[model samples]
Target: MALPCAREVFTSIFKTGAVTKKFCGQLKQLGKVCNDAFVKKTLEDPIYKNLSESAIAKKSRKTWNTCASVIDISPSSSA
Candidate 1:
């Protein structure tokens, strides 16, 4: 999981001295960008291709059901 984009952003923040020891507010944008870029890049990776396929297959194999709905007896609901 060597994300170059994320590493670059971190380096920039650290070099600018905008980041502090305790507070990491500078990471807000970096976090968002890294998350978006990582997802995009990970999907494009060859390893993710087969992995995603298998994961999807496993997900599709599972069955899910929603609970039955119950009728409301309140006067507002009746109206």
Candidate 2:
């Protein structure tokens, strides 16, 4: 049921700004986490759902300034 690694991955995506070798190593450690806890619960968390949705949504920003605002807010809340 351990979930710290999963949380670390999501946070690192924002914190590191890109996936690195360390990030991949962190993913490998997720095998230590139970499938039900990591897959069935954490990934299904509402906050994760919202973050995934926002990231994939094809939204057109009306202005340059507004684009920065949306990018700024999403990962902060997600992580």
Best candidate according to TM-score: 2
Q: For candidate 1, give the lDDT.
A: 0.31
Angstrom error of the Cα, residue 24, model 2: value is 1.4
Error of 1 at 68 (Å): 33
lDDT string, candidate 1, 1-79, tens digits: 2355344433332222222312232333334344334445655777656545444322212100000011111111110
lDDT of 2: 0.34
Against the reference, the lDDT scores of all candidates come to 0.31, 0.34
| Model 2 TM-score on a 0 to 1 scale | 0.29
